[model samples]
Target: TTDSGVGSTPAAEAVAQRLRAAGFPEADIQVIGPSARKKNVVARLHGSGKAKPILIFGHLDVVEAPKEDWSPDLDPFKFVERDGYFYGRGTQDMKGAAAIVVTNFIRWKQEGWVPARDLVLALTADEELYGDEDGVDWLLKNHRDLIDAEYSLNSDGGDFQTRDRKPYSIAVAAGEKKETILQLVTHNRGGHGSQPRKDNAIYQLNAALDRIAKLRFPVVLNDVTRAQFDALSALESGQVAADMKAVSRDPPDAAAVERLSEDPYYNALLRTTCVATMLEAGHGPSALPQRAKAVINCRIAPGHTSAEMLQTLRETIADDGVEIAWQFNEPSDPPASPLRPEVFAAVRKATDRMWQGVVLMPGMETGMTDARFLRAAGIPSYGVSGTFLEQGDGRAHGKDERIRVSDFYAGVEFYDRFMKALAGG
Candidate 1:
């Protein structure tokens, strides 16, 4: 849900309404948050007291989509079904997955089929804001008992990946890079706009940024990414395939690294990335003489620390003049979730039933997700929703965002099966 009207209250209420209709007591259907406009929905369906509870979750928040930025025929807020596709802002990242989770939960509740363990459904807000005041971490901190489970199944990260609208592989997110930010601030004496100084704050900060831009983190791969390159190596052929195999090994061939780094996606997968996202200069447009600040957002690869990343930035910028500090940083290190065999087996069972010839493998998320928080809390999280998207067409957080209707329903079935298999219903 976007902030255009009320916050995520409507979506949370919708989930609560369905749970209540399915005979869930008001106590079981909780709409909780700091305010009415911002809240999260948490409910549990009981089962036999045989195993640990399972948590299934998706974020209600979607990235903002300015109406003007989208195609003229489409509005980001309205749900439009055309050409076998459903178009909207959060259809893919990921109100759609939340809907599927709720649908399957209510379906099981209505059928009165008890599983081996309880199923917890958490439809939370502010995940797009990195779990703000109303997101998963807030819920975990405020009411951990309500949603505690053995493992969390994040429905945002997809299980099935389709390149060129064809099945490429079933990817389970076993690794996620850490998310952190470093702020650079420069202070200088104020003067008139007509009087320029070489020691100006803006100029000094810009020089440091220029140096930071040219900086590149070293190439490395954790278990998930190494497995990804190994599986994709077979799918690709010729020089690309050879490079994938080459880069998968330690002390990777220098020539292969150079060739693969040419692709932006592969490069991001290969190394930690830090890029300037926000900048603020002098207080007034006419005055650029006082201070300048810049925020460099970094997605550090696994097995690294915020301290290490900070040191890297300091050495790269090599500017003692520009003060650098952290801005609400999370732990830059969370050991990669172990690639459990049972989880992969369940994912493969569902994927094989749907996409025949598709390969199954573990992968890493270069971007951050709520899974990071859960993992840090010692609850290993597996991101294996069945959502499949066409390659080179992921418009999440961009204009004209959409998901194929076929893929959506297919994902619903796949997720339902995947969960049932995991829980042994």
Candidate 2:
């Protein structure tokens, strides 16, 4: 379901109404939001009261997709299956996973299966884009007890990479980089189109961006990345694997780091990354721009604070005229989740049952997720998805977003077993 109301209120409340119709108690299900348009839905399946609740969360929001950008005959809002893939806006991004979680919850209830502890299914809103109305943030700030759990399984993490439709490994997102958005504004005196000025706001902004484009942050590694490289070694071969291993070292190989730094994907994994996403200058094309503003989006690595990244950015820009400021309030640094043995064991058990010989690696997502907020709030949040997407098959937030039909069903089966293992069923 799409959150047409901008927040999840319309869609989430729809799901809650379905849960209520399916015999869920009123007290066990809650739809709360700061606004009526944006709501977070929570449903609890009570157990024998032996253990703390386990949270399974997925956002109900999808990134906006313009109709003109999509392929012919493909409406982003409509589900269409072709060529063994289900095409839709949220197909791969996560509405598919949310449906899986809700389906399982209903199945367990229908089968009269009781677990050792409560299982909370949280379908939240406003995760695609950030705002004060973030569903996860709102829930934690207001009704923390309704959805509080020892740990959470976030479906909005990373893709489960596969090769030739065969599962090679599942990258369990153990940690994620935090977001730091900065606004770079350059000011100049407005002038008529006929009168050319040397001090152009747009030119200064472009120059600053050019410097940022060439600049690279120093490579850094944490437990999650180190373990990721160690696991990745088995999947990769030759120098690439060797370079990965070397770069992951406590004292990383300088040559290997230098070589890997040339690659964007690998570079993002090794260090914090910032890029100019949006730019605006002048009111009209004929007018001399009085002010130019560019938005720089940074994914700060774990163990680094946003303030530190901002300071580094300021130094990199170094232009006195380019005034830099944080787009959002200063962010609190969230620590990486530890590799708990029990958690790994549980993943292994489920993976073995689903795709035997498939590896499960502790991966750190390059993009930020609500998991960071949960982790900052002292909950061990993990990005775990059973859905396996082939290499180069990821289509989240892109035109004609789709997921393999087989992979979708496989995910359904995997979560059924996974939840049982986690809840001691």
Candidate 3:
């Protein structure tokens, strides 16, 4: 709903104002940022100093949505409650979870409750922008003490995935893949449409893209994914379950990998993924292109480096004509957050109370998040929230973004339980 880069400051200020109204001192509730538009709100609920603070945070920004792009019955900017669902840009991607966390923190304060440790809530800005300068990274760099914590739970992490409208898994994102953007370029002399040649620039570019389309990086299981599948194996029954168990082992079953790779989400969890996104070719419709370029975005697995991916691309294309180069805005290559037993235990206690028998999944994010920066700064971050989304109907960053109204309230209640469990109110 809000403009992509220019954060809705009124929203951030409103959150800070709410904390103050709820008896949070002015000193503990702050709206800080580089400018008026791009701001972050951080609030604290004091606790007994029995343990270091734990942060629960999320960004205020959502991906840009144009009104014309949404369905005829919906508006991108406005929040609507209809048919047991709340419709808006950020309802699914985050803001719903943000609201839940803030409510829980305020509830604790009003009840005169004290936790075993401080609970820091950092509602930040500009996370949708890759390599953003004013969000979580900015807070950690410029004002570490305000939001520093022993560990963090990012509301950006999704929870409670459903299959056939049945709740099945509670995913705790313990790790995420770093991203590297690469541009594949092909250049040749311009010519008239009538004078086609085998070494045409456009043709060369297409061939390189075609090769990448069929390429699948070999499966490499990091600790998070390995544990994730191990749990899934017990929860699922059939060939998929066997594959999950097989892939987590030291010598991963190639046949099992092939079977699981049929699903895009599972495939992404198993290895790095590179696919062409943007393309630029001929200057005119009928003209032979003098220069053609295609951009490929790669979500790299935990252990691999961008340099290594670049080499992999070059080797795959196997063509001297293609000049592949790694693009800028490189993401942080931090190690995965160690799967601490305490965090999982807390998550399990809360999840089992709500969605009993649901799988407790310690998964990896195939997509990137600001957690990379936090992980780089030695603040272990996990993506945990009570918001549930349908498996295939996750419309985040897409048209008609919405969340089930019942699920939203359930999330509010779940956060209440989770916060109490983790901090011991």
Highest-TM-score candidate: 3
Mind giving the per-residue lDDT tens digits that candidate 1 earns over 1-425?
77656688888998899889987878777899877778999998888876778888888888788899999999999999999999999887898888788888888888886788888899888887853657788888898888888888888874566877777777788878888878899999878777777778988999999999998888878788888888878888999999999988886788998899889788888888899999998878677568899999998888777788789999998989899988868743787888888888988787777777898888888888888877887878888777788877788899888898988898889877887877775
lDDT of each: 0.84, 0.84, 0.86
Residue 220 shift from truth in candidate 1, angstroms: 3.4
After TM-score superposition, what is the CA distance of residue 263 in candidate 2 from its true location, in Å?
1.6
**Which candidate has the top score in lDDT?**
3
* Candidate 1: residue 239 Cα off by (Å): 1.9
Q: Which ten residues in a row have the lowest lDDT in candidate 1?
A: 127-136
TM-score of 3: 0.95
Consecutive 10-residue window with the lowest summed lDDT within model 3: 1-10
Give the TM-scores of the predictions, in the order they appear: 0.93, 0.93, 0.95
Clashing residue pairs, backbone N/CA/C < 3 A, model 1: none
Question: Once superposed on the true structure, which residue ranges of model 2 sit more than 4 Å away at CA?
Answer: 1-7, 132-134, 190-199, 282-289
- Give the deviation of candidate 1 from the true structure as CA RMSD: 2.2
Error of 3 at 31 (Å): 0.6
